[model samples]
Structures are given as C-alpha cells and as structure tokens.
Target: MHGLFRWSSKWWPGLIPFAILWVLAAWVSTVPLEAELAANSGTALKSTVLDKTQISVAGRDVSFAALAFSEEGRRSAVASVEAAPGVRLVNDGTRLVAEAKPFVWVAERDNVRVTLWGTAPLPASKARIVEAARAALNGTEVVDRMGLARGAPARFDAATLLLLDQVAKLKDGKIIVQDTAISLAGMARELGGREAIAAALKNLPEGFSVAANDVKAPPYVFQANKDPVAVTLTLSGYVPDNNVHAALVATAGRKFANEKIVDNLKASIGAPSGFSAAVTSALGALSRLSTGTLIVSDREVKLSGDALYEAAAGQIRAGLAKELPTGWTTKPEVSVKPAASPVDSTVCRQLFAQNLAKGRIRFETNSASINADSAGLLDRLIEIAMRCPTTAVEIVGHTDGDGDAGFNQILSEKRAQAVQDYLVKAGLPADRFSTTGYGSSQPIAGNETDEGKLQNRRIEFLVRQ
Candidate 1:
C-alpha cells in the first residue's frame, strides 16, 4: 500500500499540472468566442428588423435568440453572426415577429369636430396622436377609432403629427394615411390653406409622399354702403392685408369728395384674381349714385340705389358692365331721381302740397334733429324751391299735443329753421325762405290716437304773394 501511494503521489503532481493546462486552454479558447458573439449580437440588434437579442458563447460556438419581423431579417441575423471571427458554429433561435396587415389612418374635421380613424403602430403612438389632435383643434370634439398594428412606416408618428397640423387649417377636410402614401381633400378655411399644406408636406420624413391633394377655398367678400344724406361711406368685410385696406380707403377718399369714410375691414388670405380691379370699378359706379350700396362677393358685384338723373342711371348701367374684369358679374338696381319742372308760384304751391301729401318730414324723438327718412322728401322740396327762384315761400311747422305747448312751439320753430338751413345748403337762397311754428294749435287729426298724432305733425309750404 505504501509503494502504491508513493507512485500515486508522483503521478498525481503530474496530473495536477495537466488539469491546470486543460482549464487554461479551454478558457483561452472561449475568450475569442465570447468576444465574437458579443460583437455579432450588437450588429444584429442594430438591424431595422431585429429586436430582443440574447447571445451565449461556448468555446468556438455562438448561440443567439432574437425576434425578427421578416424572413429576410432572420436570414440577415444568421449571416451576420456566422461571419464573426473565430466562430465555428452558430445556433440561431430567432423567431419571426407577429404578422400584421398594412396600416391605414384617417383624420377628418368639419367645423369644430375632428375624428380620427384606423390603425396605429403602438399604444403609445395612438395616445400621443389623440392628445396632439385635441390640442391642435381648440374648442372642438376629437374622436378616435384606431387599432394597434405591428408594422409602421418609417417616421409614422412624425408624419401623422404633421398631417394633424394641416387638418387644423381646414374648415372641413379629411387626411388619409395608407402605409407611406398620404392624401388630403376638403375645403380650406383660408385662401392660402392649400399652399400652406403643400409647403408643410415638403418637410416630411423619407418614405412618405402625398398621393393626392384636393382642397377648395372659401369666397372672398368685400362690401361698401354709401349714404349721401349722412355724407359717409362704410367699408366692411375682409381685406387681404393692411396695405390693401389702406389703398382702398385712399381710393374712396379720392373718388367721393363729400363722403366721410368708415373702415371696418379685417385682414385675411385668398384674394380673388381680379379683386382690386373689381372693387375699384364698383367704387367708380358707386360714386355716380346719390345713395348706393356695393357688395363684392368674390367675382360677383352688386350695386343698388338712386342715381342722380335718368341719363346718369343709363350710362352707369352700360359702362360698369364693360369695365368689370373677366369672369365677373355685375347687378345694378338704380333708379333715377325725377327732375323738378318749371312752375309759377301757384303751381309751385300745388306741387309742394302734393309732395308733402306723399310723405311728411320726420324729426328725431324729442328733438329738432331731422331724421334720415326725411332726406328724400327734403331733396324734392329743395328741387321745387330752386325751380321757382323768384317766388318767396314760408315753411310753417306744426306738432301733436303730446308735449307742453311752449315746448312743442320751440321744437316746431327749431325744426322749420332746420329745414330752411338744409335747403340753403342744397343751393337755394336763404333770403327766399321764411320759417314759423304753430305748435299743437292746428291739428288736422285727433290727438288721442298714435296714427292721428303722426298725421297731425306736419310742415306746410305757403307761397308768399
């Protein structure tokens, strides 16, 4: 037994060195395999289709498990790991990612409501889109009808977010995203909405392209009302910008010398092709009218009111149509003011009575201020007074019994004086007219009823002998 032990001890020392050498050799061989596996695993994970990679190395052998969405991706991962340095064997446990159909999405907006539909790449992407849409469309309803899908185009989230921005600019429209191709259609809220969308689409990420764009713009409306009695012209509605607005105001000032301009224009995009030309021509027509309103709605021009004379009415109707731009339509509803005929003092008194019988002069409530409704009647009276230049006339005012006698007398006197002043301004001689007031002493009708009181208030023209 001692002899066996002695032999064993010498061999055991030798075996110890061999065992150490074997362990060292095995460890040395595994270092390069481990390094190659790590390098190849990194490369595989960086691929567009590969995910969730795990790698193990045993000597010269490498084993990897990863998820791939396509057959090409699996083949690519296997080839990449096989090419690693000092790798003799590769074990691929790669499984194909779940298959999914192509993704499609649509966002539609009508006035204040926005609706989203179709597939989203992930739960996070869907939530992000809904939140962004809500923010973009303020004071609007946003509805989502989206489902999750495994495959999405490159920069899908970014492309959809950009489309949502475009949707906000539309008055009513729909944006469709089918895989990488996008289409937009509907009415644009502004004139530049379509152009703005095109510009934005240019910045979209790669693999995204516009399939179709069909957007319509709203009509541009410009309106003006000329009041000759008030000596004012009111401009309201949309103008392209401040420069255009200022130019229009300046033009109105130059054309109508006696008119005071009131500008109530707002800035907006999308002026029609011949907006300025149409507006300028309409203003020219309006200047010929004694009182008129001009409305320019896109390519349509509408003018209505009284012309100074019959000849002027016919000339304006014929000339304005020829002056308008191509593709423009003009509608003029003009009536000529009748010229006063020459008459003697007796005939003049009879005409005055007939004219006053048609409509009485109107005064402001509780004041001597002449109301606008009396302008036409006053104009007719002035014309008649001017025709009989040598005849002296008296404008006598009367009132109903609604107020105190003294107050009514004062109001009537002031009102007669107001009429006299207006006629003088209309080019009649101030010395040829005289004014008086009778108050409620001469009522032609009963003062107990509103209609009777309205009839009782009058201004009589008495021819001076």
Candidate 2:
C-alpha cells in the first residue's frame, strides 16, 4: 500500500493536465449554440465566451462558439455539443468583441421630448414641429414637448405696426386689443384730432401699451412724409422718430395737417406753452413723409431733425385699408409712379463702367486671396475692361522672388487665372480674357522694400490696342 501511494503521487502531476483538459471540454460543450460555432465543429455550435472576459457577444444564451476542443481526443466531445442549430469551433476561452457603435442618437430615449428653436415659418411653425415629431415616433403614442418661437415678439413701436397688420389700442393710458377696436393713451403731439392718434396704431399687431414719453420736443413746426414707390421717407423737424414708413402714415396724418391736394404745400406753426407746441411740432414733422404735405394748417408747433431708415412698406399698407383710414377722416393721395431701386455702385460697375483709374492688385499676406477692401476696386477694373469692343485683354500676374522660382511661377500663373475666372463669373466674356504668369522676371517695382514688393505682386492689364 505504501508503494502504491508513492506511485499514485508520482502519476498525479501528469494526470492533473488531462483532468483539466477533460473539464475544459465539458465546460465548452455547455456553451450556447450559434452558426459560427457549427462551422468549427462537425455539428452546430451553442455559445461563445469572449476572451474569458466580461466584454462579449452571444446569440441569446447561445451563440456559435461551443465547439472548441482542448485536445485531439476531445474533438468529438466538442462536436457533439456543437451539432446544435447555431454552433462553431473555437480555442479555449478565446474570442473577439465589437468595439464601436454604428448608429446616431436621435433622442435620449424613444419617449424623450424634442424642442426646436429658430425662425418660425410665420403662421404654421408650431404645427410643423408637431408633425415632424409624429413622423419620428412611427405611430407610437408620445407627448409632444415641441413648440415654436419667433425670435421674441419684436419690440412694439411706431415701426412695429409695419410688421403686424393688426394694432392694439392705448386708451386712457390703458392698453386695449379687440377686433377693429383700437386706442392710444398719451398726450397727442401734433395730433390734430383724437381719431388721428388711433389711426396710426391700426397697423400694430393686436397689442398696445404707452411707455412714458421722455423725448423733448422742438418749439417750431416740423414735418415728415413717407413714399411707398421709392420705399423711402423724409424728415424735416426735431421729431425723435426715424423711418416713419408707410406703417405710420394714416394715424400720423392726424397729428399734422396734410393737404388733400396733390400740390406741395408748406406752413409754419405757433407754440402754445411750456414747449408743448414744440413737442407737437416735432412729432408732426414725421407726417410730411407721406405722399402729400401735412401743412401746419395754423397751430403752435415745434421743430427738430429726426432719423430715417429703409422699412417694409408693404407691411404698413396691410395694416390699414389702403384707400380708407380705419380711424381717421383724412384721405391719402395715391401716386402713379412705380417704386424706384435704391442707388448703389454694385450694379453699375457690374454692367457699366464710367472709367478706370488707380487699378492695382493688392496681394494677400503670403497668400493668393484678394483682399476684401480690393473687391470693389477690382470690380471697377473688370467693368472698364468690358467696354473695349471686339477686344481681348491679357491679365498678367507677377510675384516677387521670395520663394522657389518654379513655385512662385506656378502661384503667379494661378493668380492670373483666378482673376480671369472671377471676371467671367461677374458676367464678363471669358473668351476675351487670357491669363499669364511671369514669376519674378517681370517686376514693375523694386522688390527690396515692402511697398515696392506689393507693387510687384500685381496684375497688369494690356488691351490689344
């Protein structure tokens, strides 16, 4: 028995390895079934153990990795387990795990709420947001937290009437907003009658309020008027208001007297007391901007200069009955002239050229982009080049020799072509313009000084003449 014990101890070391292999085979056979495991074993596989770590991928409780064998003798043992529907062979506890996600997150979760912010589509931005949310939900019942905001209801002013066709009433210093019923609650400056004050607020959106009037008034007659055709209004007194566009026309006509006549009429006003007349005159000045004159018609008025700006006249017209003043008894004389375009040099230089002078190329700092300040000047040059009939111009580009000659030559050539491209895009004849680069070879100015270097980095225009 002692000899037997010694022999068993000696053999235990060798037997322990086989025992571990057997245990591994048994454990592997119990793995979940999968198709990948089936390919490795003679039969389908059951499950996978990923890298012997917590990170893993498996088909339910069974994925294709159960057919792994620790020894040749155990191959059949693993195969038997792998023969199930979804099984494959693998090494002992060795596997791969996916490392990345492939989808984008639309919301925190399926039932999460969404709220959007931006310019609303005028009337239906709220409804549109709801509809978009419904589409995303795919018929699942979910609460909609989505809504719309229009940058904040714009600040109410005489100009606010132009944006909102409806206006609120300021009555007895109180705010009132009802359909077709409007009022104003402050001392009427230049206001000839109470009805005239109500008429101006008609163009405002359905809300009204009177802020404290702290603006001082002039002691002389002031006048202003608005022109829809030219989309411009003029001011002639100490009226603090500027840009008294079409929106303020009807009600404003009340504070000052406007001739029902088409002829240009003028007048001066008298002051009542304590600058009240001056204040009225200042507010009255805004009325002259209308199509007809708002003659002082004999009153103590004030005067001062007011500011002006371009405004949306259409919005103003929409606020009132164009032919009828909703709250006033005055008539706005309609003009037959068409609206005029605002004057600027952009269109002129694009289509017509008066002449070209001081045409020079301003280079980008160590680069090729034309400076912003130079765009207008360059536009003028292109315009003049267009006037030469049946002519082609060679646009030559040059560079100072600061870098590699070959590179500089290439850059210079590209710069010329860029100019040519711009001209053609600006409606010039592409066929009439040719680009060439001379690198540092053709320097019109010395390259030693910074100012002279700028002159060298230029485009020269030569006509066939």
Candidate 3:
C-alpha cells in the first residue's frame, strides 16, 4: 500500500501543471468574447438617447445599465445587448429619465443677478446652456438651477439660445419657455430695445412662437437745458424720427438765435401724441427764460427756469398749459430773475426790435384779446420796457388792408391801448407810455399776398430819445 500511495502523489504533482494550463486557456478564451460582446452592445445603442451607459460581461452573460430618454429606448437597449452574438442574457438595469409634462425653462434677471432654472433635456444640454448664459451676460452674475429631464420640445437647444439673445436686451425681466411657446416680461434697457426684440422673434425656429410679450419701454423723454453761462441750448433725449429732430433743431435756432445749440438728441420711437407741437411750445417757453430746463416725459411737460422778469414768470406759468395739445399736461416751476440795470432809450429800442423780429404779438381774430401763444414774446417786450424805466415810449399799432378803415382804426387803437395797460399792470409807469393807431395807412409790406399781409400788421415801440 505505501508503494502505491508514493506512486499516486508523484502523478498528482505532475498533473498540477496541466490543471493550471487548462484554467489559463479558459480565461484567455472568454476575455475576447466578453470584450466583443461589450463592443457590439455599445455599437447597437449608438443611435439611442441614453446616458451613463455601462455594459459588463461575465461568461457571456451581459449586464446592461443606462438612463434612457424613453421607455422604448430603454427596452431596445436591453434587447440589443441580449441579442449580441455571445451574450447569454441581459441583466437590464436600465430606467427611463424623469419626464416633465410641458417641460418649462426660465431665465430671470433682477438688478444684481440673472438666474436660469428648470429642466434640460440632457447633461450636455445643461452644460451648454449654463455656459452660454455666462457668455451673453458677461458682467452680470449668472446662476444655474437646472436639472436633467425628458420630453423637451424638438430643437430645444436652438430655441433656448435664441431666447437668451432677447434676455440681453432687458434691464430687468424674466423669459419663459414652455414646450414650443415662449413668453417674456420685463423693462427694456434702451428706447428701441422692445421693438428690436420683437423683430428678432421672427427668426426663431419653425415650431416656436411668442405666446406673450409684455415688455414695456422706458419713459419717452425729451429734455432741453438752457444754460446762460455756456450760451448754449443743450437738447438731449429722444425724438420720434429724423424729420422731427431736424425741425426741432431748426426751431431752436430761430427761437434761441444767440445761443449755440448742442444737439444730443437721438431718434427713437414711442413719442407722445402731438410730440412735435408740445416740444415746440415748450422750447418757446424755454427761450424766454434767462436759464431753464425743459423735460417732456410722455404727455407731461415739466419746465423749470428763471424768467426774464416777474410778469414774464407769471405769464409762462399760466400760458404754457394752455398752449399744449388736448390730453397733455404741464407743470411750470418758474421764478423771476433779478432786475437788470437800467438801459438808455436807444438800447431799449434795439431790444424791442430784436424781440418783435423773433415772433409776433398775436390777437384773437378782429378782437384786441391777445393770444396765449404770444405770451412769451409779450413777456419779452415787458422785460425790455422794465429796463428803460425812465424813458417815455410811444406804442404804435397797424393793421392789414382787409378790414374796413374805420373799424381797423378803432381796432388798432384798442390794441395799442391794450399794450399800454399790460405794461402798467406789470408795475411800469403808465405816464411814460403813449398809444397810437395808423390803421392800414402805415403799411411796411404790400397786402397782395398772405406773406405780405402778415408783415403789414405790426406793433412798433418808438422810444422817445
């Protein structure tokens, strides 16, 4: 028995090497099969929407796991691995991603920061959107509060990128994308920003449309500052178009002929109704002031300045609102300047001539009641009269040839008397003034044309030298 056991032990030691070789051969053979199975399964799922895909093989049994975009995609991924040439079975540890009904995304901005929240279709999509927001809002802080989801609309990334462009135009606001619809609400940073965004929406992808756009424009403001020290009328703010801009600049030249115009006005939309008329009238009031500021915001006009004299201040306050269009409002903060030093009758006559040449002292048709539109010019006349307090002045009134001579005579006399009474009421001495009427006899221009007729009616200040 001892001899037989010794012989068996020697044979067992010899067979150990063969056993090792057989195990090595089995392992080496299965490695290639497992690798081939994994490769084939992955290739099958290449066209599927899946995330965090993993495939493992142990003796040709496949373990497939992934987050799929849809239940069908998940089932197909498992089946693809099970059908692989060497795969015995698929473990099928796969799940559909969370679905968002009417998937929504939002980007909100306040004074300090812009925040992006809601669902992204994929991890790659999430990363791309956050990076895009940071790029667009360069200085502004951008926060990401987004997560992964399924059921995003088609062309989701393209639509989101386009909507982000509009966000750059807002001062502060929010933009929302729900499925294929987009909505925006906020205040625009610039005068025409609202329109620009609306125009841009036309280029959005075919499936998307604007559901609601409540973007409001900032105030439509037109401002003018009259600076006596600078001898400049600085016009700044908005105009409806280039034509109104040119007309305002020209009118400023005529009204403030002595002052240089510093035009800083920009052309934009959103001008109030009667914008040109309101601005023109406001500029006239501003011209009468030694220094003033005019602000027209929407339909409201706010004027602040020191008028040339006390009476002029009162007249501007009372007449400015009346000159505005219907539905327009005015707030005048007028004050009287310090009295100017007395001037000789020669200087006073020249001042009166300059004032009359700029504008006319108009009256109601056939009546001596002065038009409110003439208040600024009339105030200028009052200021010049105050400067020459000691001089006796003759106020002469004339008319065009359209009226009956007798009636024209009476009308002209009454007009002259009205001037004298207005000056007396403004604290000027009535004894230093005389009134006269020439009717249509002292015509400076022919009455054949309307332009000539306009020039024929005149009021002359003759300072007694």
Candidate 4:
C-alpha cells in the first residue's frame, strides 16, 4: 500500500489531466448540436456559359483570361472534372480530379461549406468560371469540376482553353493564339512589330486577348520586324568577345528578332521602360560571358571548356543581378519576351500617309484637327515612337487634286507639318524628322473615284534605320 501510494503520487499529475481531458472530449462529442449553428457554405456559379468565357467579379462574361487571386483573400481557385449542374453525384470531397472540361471538389472551413459545382473550367474556362462563381456568390470558395449552370451550354469550350494557353504564353510578350483574331489594344514598336504579332496571331485557331488599354488603333497589318534579343560583350583590348556576342546572338537573337529588327533596342528607343530590364540583363549577361569561351556556329552557340559548361549559369546570374535592382535577388533564370501587341508608329505613319488604307480613321471635311475616332490610332503611333526611338523618319503628306494646285500643296504641307508637329510634341527629335508634300502627284489608286482619292490622300513615314 505504501508502494502504491508512492507511485500514484509520483505519476498522478499526468494521470489526472489525461483522465479529465478524455472525459471532457467524450462529453463534447456526445452533446446535442443544432444544424442551424453550423457554418455557412460559400456560393458558386450556378449555371454554365454556353460558350465558356471569362467571368469577372461583376458576373458579366468578358473575353479576358487573366484573373488575379490571393491565397488568404475572399476566395481561391481549383481545377476539377466536368459535371453538369443537377447531374449525378459522381465524385465528392477533396479527392480533387482534373479534366479537360472542369474539376469537382468541395471547400469547407469554420463549419462553412461551399461546393463549386462548375469545377473551374479547364485553365481555359477558369477565368469565366471563377468570375461567374465569384460574381454569383459574393464570398465563395472556388471548386474546380462542377458542371453546367442551368442555362449554360454543353457544347465546345475549346475557345476558353485556347485563350488560357495564350495567356500563359504571354510571358515572352508574344501574342499567343491558335485560331481566332487576337487584336492589339496597346502600343507597339515599328509597324513591323505590330504585323509580326498579328501574323503570328493570324494562324491561331482560337481567339486571343488584346490589352484592355485603348491604344490599339485599327488597320492592323504586319510588316514583320522581329527584334532579336541583343547582348554585347565589350572585349577588353583583344580577348575576342566577338565569338561570345556571336554565340549569344545565335542563341537569343532569333527569339526576339522576327522580321527586320535584329535588336529591339537598336531598332528604336521609344520608351526606356520597355527595354530597361532587357538592356540591363543583356549587358550583365555579356559581362558573365566574359568569363567563358564559346564556339560560335552559323546558327548555334556551343559552349566548351570548364568555364563554357557554366556559361548559362554565369549569364543568368549576371543578367538577373543587373536587371533586377540592388537588394533584389532573381531566381537565376532570365526570360525576356516581346510585347504581346505592338503598335508601330512608323507603320501608323505609313498608314496615315496612305489614308488608313480604307477608312481606318474618319476625318472632318478638309481639315487636319484629326477625327475624334482617330484618337486610338494616333495614340498607338505615339506609343510606337516612345518605344522605338532610333527610328529616323520622314512624314510625307499627300492630297487629292481637287482644289487649286497651290491650295492643294499648302493643305498637303499643313497635313505633313501636323504629323511632324505631333511627333515633335510627343518628344521626338525635330532634327530626325523631315516633311514633304506630294500634292496629288503620287497616287496609288485612281483619282476618278472618291475612295481612290481618299487612298491617295494620306500621311506616310519612311523608317530609316
């Protein structure tokens, strides 16, 4: 009895707490609980869109693919299988499954449960599904894989998928598409760059997104100026950086250069913001390449030697270090992409010289104030000049031979001067510009018809290196 008492005294401290805790737990579980006291399940998109599209917080379907999120925010997103609304209960719970169509899952926290019926549409449909779901239920958890809202379509959701793919590929600034026309809604470099993006997009089977910005002007055409990514290694005396630059050019230049531009920076310096990172990174990469040797080929950059094997590593670090600001360390991987949509000031100038080819802008009767609707295209041109600055140009204005020869000449000069004035006001060097008037002399189309005359009356810019 003495031994027992001693043992109990020594271990009783732990035993008492364990016994009390177990009993309390059991009691809590056994207590009657009201379902009304349970937490609420959030909301979801009740219906599917016949043609799957991006759904914004407003619940309206938009064509954009980008949807921003935060892990601790009001909502989150997931992918799942395709299950139409009011359909069978195939899979449920966190056993989340993914399909080309949609996902299926349930979300719960704080006794609150929200089952996302239309599993977020495949990556493609995600924008629309998430938008719709969030719009319908103010505070909702997004589950991937629930199916059709009552009135939504069950047909092809392919467009949504393609758009998602395009959006994903936007990192390199290349406009992505598989089929549909992807419009440019922002500024671009040379008109060639605009055309390059357009041409690349023209073959896409699925439609694409334009920048929501209003800088996109009409009369979209491609001149094919792919600016090659450039990295110049300044050789000290005669260590031969040519091989290195050559190799670097072979490796990255092809990616950036498409048509006429070998290096976007060299092509034109319109805005420092666009190429600032690229310039810094490229220069840093050039510095790193100084540490390695390259065997330059006609089209390939092959690295050799102990240092050569580490060329990519050296280049990435150097590029990232210089490109990113001090105190900011990069991931050691550098990726530079072209603009998604390019606005070619040079090309726009050309179009203006040619009267927007066919009604690109609506002008007032015999005036040069520019039409209100012409603002979009004009904005695009301004953007191009800002992006590509090395471009030297001549703004030539033309007129139809309807009025007196002298009057026509004066009108043509005023128009050319107007273009020149706008460019100069936008910070272009007046020295880089020269204007000429061809009063009804150089006509592409006939003067017999108003349409032909309109074509003849235009403002064009000849882009000189």
Per-residue lDDT of candidate 3, residues 92-152 (tens digit): 8898888999899999988888899989998788888888888888888989998778999
Which pairs clash in the backbone of model 1? Answer: none
Q: What is candidate 1's CA lDDT for residue 223? A: 92
Q: Best TM-score goes to which candidate?
A: 3
Give per-candidate clash totals. 0, 59, 0, 58
Candidate 2 wrongly placed segments (more than 4 Å): 1-357
| Residue runs of model 1 more than 4 Å from their true location after superposition | 1-102, 227-231, 240-243, 266-269, 305-313, 333-465
Candidate 4 vs. true structure, TM-score:
0.26
What digit string (tens of lDDT, one per residue) describes model 1 on residues 267-375? 8878887788778878878876778899988888999988755555786688789989999999998887656567898888987898788667878887888864455
lDDT of 3 at 259: 75
For candidate 2, what is the lDDT?
A: 0.40
lDDT of each: 0.82, 0.40, 0.87, 0.39
Per-model TM values vs. the true structure: 0.51, 0.27, 0.70, 0.26
Could you tell me which 10 consecutive residues in candidate 2 have the lowest summed lDDT?
A: 99-108
Alpha-carbon runs more than 4 Å astray in model 3: 1-68, 71-95, 111-113, 127-141, 199-209, 341-374, 396-427, 436-460
Among these predictions, the greatest lDDT belongs to 3
The per-residue C-alpha lDDT of model 1 at residue 86 equals: 66
